[model samples]
Target: VTLSDLDPPNAYRISGEGSGGVAGYAKGGALVRLESESADVTVLHYDVDAQIGGKLAQLGARLINSTATKLAGEFFKSFADVVSAKAEAS
Candidate 1:
């Protein structure tokens, strides 16, 4: 996942790619708007979902929540690093 062009005091865009191993691969993007603020800021969210395969291929009904959480955390850090580097360059 990645966030870029963080035009501060307003909004940002997040773009990402995901692969579900033998299942499928997906990529998504969304824009986040800062709708409210105080000492802390609140964001309005948006998301997109897309896949590379048919629905019938999903057979199991298992939830790997921990794995998902870990991966998401890693992705968030990576995204932060990428955006930080870009900001530094500018």
Candidate 2:
């Protein structure tokens, strides 16, 4: 799905491909949840996938994997930051 409805505190299945027009194009996203650990803490559980295909994948698996890894890491970092801020405000 191009857009997702990710309601936290519940597990989910995630997958997608990215636009391949760019050099570092990758498919990257995650299945994640924020579970309350206590009144002051929340835990994130996640499984993430990042893929590169078409001309991007032709660059070899190592290149694709590396690019995907970076993309996924950035994505999760940004996502977590947003979630963390939201939790703190609640």
Candidate 3:
């Protein structure tokens, strides 16, 4: 993936083309933004998109969509855990 259009402490975008095996059958991107809500809280807004082709697409939209959703959830949860740990360390 390539990281671009970055605005530190606020927003960034990540985009990339598919490469190799099952990955070669798909391409995806994400946009993530952070908005401060209060002294101790911040809100994260994200948009994700994916396009699938080849044999992978034959797996049906329901399966593919659910897998993507699960991955995204795990990603954000892991991100939050890391950030929380860093804040505590600071």
Estimate every model's Cα lDDT from 0 to 1. 0.55, 0.69, 0.79
Candidate 1 per-residue C-alpha lDDT over 39-59 given as tens digits, one digit per residue, 9 for 90 to 100: 443434343333343331354
Off by more than 4 A, model 3: 20-24
Counting only residues 3 or more apart in sequence or on different chains, how many pairs clash (N, Cα, C under 3 Å) in candidate 3?
0
Task: Kindly list the per-residue Cα lDDT of model 2 for residues 1-90, writing each as its tens digit.
Answer: 553655644555566765856564667666777687888776767666667666667768686666666776787789889978997888
State how far residue 47 of model 3 sits from its true place (Å).
1.8
Off by over 4 Å in 2: 2-8, 18-29, 51-55
lDDT of 2 at 26: 66
lDDT of 2 at 27: 71
Across residues 6-35, which tens digit of lDDT does each residue of candidate 3 receive?
999999998777655853377777788999
Error of 3 at 51 (Å): 0.8
| Collision pairs in model 2 | none
What are the models' TM-scores? 0.40, 0.55, 0.78
Residue 1 displacement in candidate 2 (angstroms): 2.9
